[model samples]
Target chain A: MQGSQFRLEHGKKVRLANMDPNETGSLHDREEAEPNIERLKERLEALQNMLYAEKKQSVLFVIQGMDCSGKDGVVKRALGGLHPQGFQVHSFRTPTEEEEAHDFLWRAHRIVPAKGMIGAFIRSYYEDVLITRTHKWISEAEVKKRLKHINRFEKLLESSGVKIVKIFLHISKDFQLAKLRNRLTDETKRWKFDKNDLVERESWSAYEEAYEDVFKQCSTESAPWYVVPANHRWYRDLAVLQIAVDALESMRLAYPASDPELDQLLEQLQE
Target chain B: MQGSQFRLEHGKKVRLANMDPNETGSLHDREEAEPNIERLKERLEALQNMLYAEKKQSVLFVIQGMDCSGKDGVVKRALGGLHPQGFQVHSFRTPTEEEEAHDFLWRAHRIVPAKGMIGAFIRSYYEDVLITRTHKWISEAEVKKRLKHINRFEKLLESSGVKIVKIFLHISKDFQLAKLRNRLTDETKRWKFDKNDLVERESWSAYEEAYEDVFKQCSTESAPWYVVPANHRWYRDLAVLQIAVDALESMRLAYPASDPELDQLLEQLQE
Candidate 1:
């Protein structure tokens, strides 16, 4: 339940999120953590080629985090070099009137990648279960049903050979409050600081509790959740990259074998 | 009206589409005809930096083309470098029940780029005029009204500083027929050779006429239409890239200067 227990055993030091709502983690460590830039960049380039050629084993990355917890920055940095053709990032917002009418998972279902693709879901279906629970938008029984639906939905995705790597960008309430205040003062970001975000901020403890219960109910071995410390941007970015790279490596994808024509194409490009 | 007249006096190429839809230009002559791969790569990296910094200009690119004319491939190739955070690609399909109820431009409008981003529309509002005209899904009068609305829509976008680039991937019907046959014969491609496409191929001349009328009606100086020669994939890719690069370059975006401390942060990355 504590931060210490959340440590990942992958030689890569990946960590799942803490299940305990009260456990405090030292997000400061991310400030001092250095990125293996050269190594990581080379690996990403290789992954892009492998991804393009293998064209199987779709990846769905779910990024869940507190507001201003560096989720967007981490996502942008982590997948920077991947080919757009082989990958997509779907950012989920408040469901439209149309989407709200369907099952909460309907919109999220359509964005899952086809075979041989990598998809990142920002503020994903979990929002339905988490935010709806926090706001008491649905009954407790309905919330439990949705959570069960989520688990089954993920199980279906895993059965279809889609690898799901979920990460919760963990930050302290103090840091979030500071960010909200900064948004109010910053000219460029002021427009983005919605009144609802402040209202959502006020229910921080409630949201956290909702998240904890959802994690316990839905985090299975098939689709694990990684909790990345987000107070320090550097560490959070590195942690995300490490987790994603680890997941892809586990897939054991390789560059498609070069045909004679493939060699000819490379030669022509060189020419 | 001939291919010989498809030359640019200034940087702006004359809209030869209206004169002779058949006289497709040679892709080899386009500015990006032979994409200097190395330079393209450097340009893409710089583009990413600008996109992150500006985060201000959301661009929407609309691509319209005939069947087997390579809209999908061109989209996949041209946007290969752009970060998804700063760009999104939405391919419009046949209108659903809700989409059918709105104005022809409504669904397309709903998906336009937010300020300071890029959206690529594969088939867009123009469909109301083009496909509806070709298929007779609506009366000719409705098509005309939709065309006028689209012109106004693009004009409004331009006035609001959205660089509207409309591309029609011009291909000979003979080429399409040949590709169709190849698709029918090849197992890998046979899946893509839909019966609907076969029926549409029978009405090739009708579709061409519809496209010609569309060009005549909506081709304005503010949102001009370019007809790219798409018989050759390399040529089509280069032409599309030329249009995209031209649009982005004209924006004259500067790297958002973050606080001086940003440089210090980069210094830490180096260390």
Candidate 2:
């Protein structure tokens, strides 16, 4: 599948400079991709039903992206078709006073989807590494220590039946500038524009370097990072949907087996 | 609305014996109710959208019922039509070792829905008062103390922009027996039957009385308990839907006003 091309291999050095932010593999236009996007959505919904029925495993999608990289848009357009009862989306922001008291992972750990559920964290504990390191809020030694903690945390969740799919929506510096200008000019999108984004843009290269380090340190065999080219919103949505559907399909999910005394029970119930 | 009749008035003495579990007010049959249920579901979806857009207040539906009283069924049939993105359902079972280490309300308080969300707790902190009391696990004075704490906790949630709607799914002893038997005989439902339910059935009256005490103590003007007659699954689903819709409507939810610079922004975007 086109999604496999984006999956970063573990223990390999990642150079964000080498990865194109506008790559749309195989597909040439939005019209051609629309039908496939719809099909994948239907498959995702069906797979979610089986996951809920099986009640044995769960899935977590950790979505990371720069501002205006379409994190919210991908969720609304791609995986929004799943049963709301089984699918949940949580957008992480600045930690609350209570959250600040505990270790960084405490808040995320509490809300990790239970068995038979699918959860998405718009920006996750990786924020502890990315944002904290970018702002020099934590020391270099602290970043190294937190990376080890994050790897162990993902491994713990994976062992406990959570299929983790980490997706990084990659958009170019020019693309982010265009989105920011559009946000300023479009009132409907104005609510989403943040002044800090412009300030963060100045540190674009620094942020990219930080992300590269995160990929090298945290990506694992069980939960590798998929860096999606996200300049075109249509391609970004399709790629994330394909990656999610592929992850769930690979789990070999099925409904729980029927009862042994089904005929007898049916007759008794009928009576 | 027919739902108002089921909304227990605050400070009034509640007698479960007086409330007919089989009562189907204003509707003679399921066909008569189906259309109204559909309308209510649509209204609920619209209201939920407004609530989410407003992003100021949240709604919490605390669903309490006996083992066979159809708590799960009501959620699926009635509220299931909601946009899954804004609606969340959390089913509380026995507390884990971590949950047990904290106060009873600690675990529940942490998971309450945030602003612009609707959360339903299949069973809630009320378990501390009901099961704990029925089994004499906690002293009567302790139950009284916990009841006060619960009222306070609910008020806190209300002050922080939560609309609390407590629902008690009232079912007759005979009706429960029939459902239990169906679970035993029906192959698909066999997994739902618990041996402990039979043990708890022996203490049905104690549970009922304990529930009555809870209604008297915990029911507040801000958050009243609605005793939904649950003998007929159709009526139960419809009534809960009606009550939920009414509570959200009473909040008078509205989308945030359009931006003041919308026209100018549109002009700029067009350019």
Candidate 3:
């Protein structure tokens, strides 16, 4: 599916209740989606190889999702085929002392992928506006100010060859409950369960409202946000893969033009 | 096939002439070594997953080699299976003006893998001692001084729980000629033919001597150097993969001990 179908329209009001998290378009099940998943994964890798060779534009995947929404899973399943040398994923948690000392974007700005690489931010500076606003830790005015900062920060990145693809993994509240229960019961996955997630779950509606505002204010024409369906894991992976492939394919990546002197140099080496 | 056999012995004088760049041990051809290469690549992915979950120590693979020595190729073939989120590769080229203003180790120090990640440095701070010394850009005494600085710098990193695996892709002069010719003649690879590679080829012996001194002076037991034969690309890939897997395996990685609080949380969730 084209990401534009789900992309947040600029200046349009967003209501989380209106969007269906379980919708999978024309596709039905994991089995049916498997072929396209494999094809897109291969295409993603081929495009990444060209991006690495071209060394001109970089791609950033900003993925944000609530508890048990499969943020990390989508990256591993959809984008994992990428060569490690040219791809990096960054997960922002509670800021370190040094990071907290600076503006919210400082930590992220320092490690934005250099030209020729792809970087994924599992949860990024968006958290500053999300959790802070949802928890009432920061005043609503402060949230507005930060959103403005975010739009500007993204524009700055876009102007300089960073193609930002912001993604919000949309999952129903019931789906989250199932995922959380499974994590708690599975012996191997119990380590991943946190009581704090339960506390965060209480603020789900607040989080949704905050995200809607972000989509309306921060999702610009140059750097739009995709609200991907995450209730169905298979569909989620395929959609994210298509979004990633489309993002790179639009960059028009190519290997550097062969140097004119190479012919003369080739003759010298032959001798 | 053990890395120890090729490891530079600390506190011993080194001679590049004695080691065989074309050595493949018992392996005869690419087909014969394919099984081990596949096995090791799979093993590497498993180990890296543990390292990411364990989130304690980081691994740094410092790769150094002459022109056409396959530094980039080795990472693509041997370590490419890694999850890009936890793996990063850095290729140090001519230092930027800002990087040159700081100490040689400054740039490398800032980007060492955070705990739980793996990083590969294509060319690193060692270049300060190498290219500068070989071309007489700096005095011999200055090179000696930089070598001392590098040893201490590595020790500092080792103490901070960074497992360092230094590798030298040892390929012969003749082998490089063949690789360079291939690049020049291949339309797709012609962009990789750097004229400076020809310039650096003239100082091959000087470069070897500089590297030998580095191996003798900087190869600490905590972070020893492996001189892997690279004339055969298949053997090179397998050996590097084995070294990488062994490094992570030795770290005793494990999932965070299931938090005792998680059991109570699980009980509460079930209610």
On DockQ, the leading prediction is 3
Q: Across residues A84-167, which tens digit of lDDT does each residue of candidate 1 receive? A: 555678778879999989988899898898887888888999998888889899989998899889989998998887988888
Residue A132 of model 2, lDDT score = 88
Clashing pairs in 3: none
Interface RMSD of 2: 4.9
Candidate closest to the true structure, highest lDDT? 3
Cα RMSDs, all models: 9.5, 5.2, 2.6
- Candidate 2 residue pairs in clash (backbone atoms < 3 Å): A84-B84
The deviation in Å at residue B69 for candidate 3 is 1.6
Q: What is the lDDT of residue B166 in candidate 1?
A: 79
What TM-score would you give candidate 1 relative to the actual structure? 0.61
lDDT of each: 0.68, 0.87, 0.88
Worst 10 residues of 3 chain B by lDDT: B186-195
lDDT score at residue A258, model 3, on the 0-100 scale: 80
Q: Of the candidates numbered 1 and 2, which has the greater TM-score value?
A: 2
Identify the superior model by DockQ, candidate 2 or candidate 3.
3
Query: Which segments of model 1 are wrong by more than 4 Å?
Result: A1-59, A64-88, A91-118, A123-163, A167-217, A226-271, B1-38, B41-45, B48-52, B256-271
Q: How accurate locally is residue A121 in candidate 3, as Cα lDDT from 0 to 100?
A: 96
TM-score of 2: 0.74
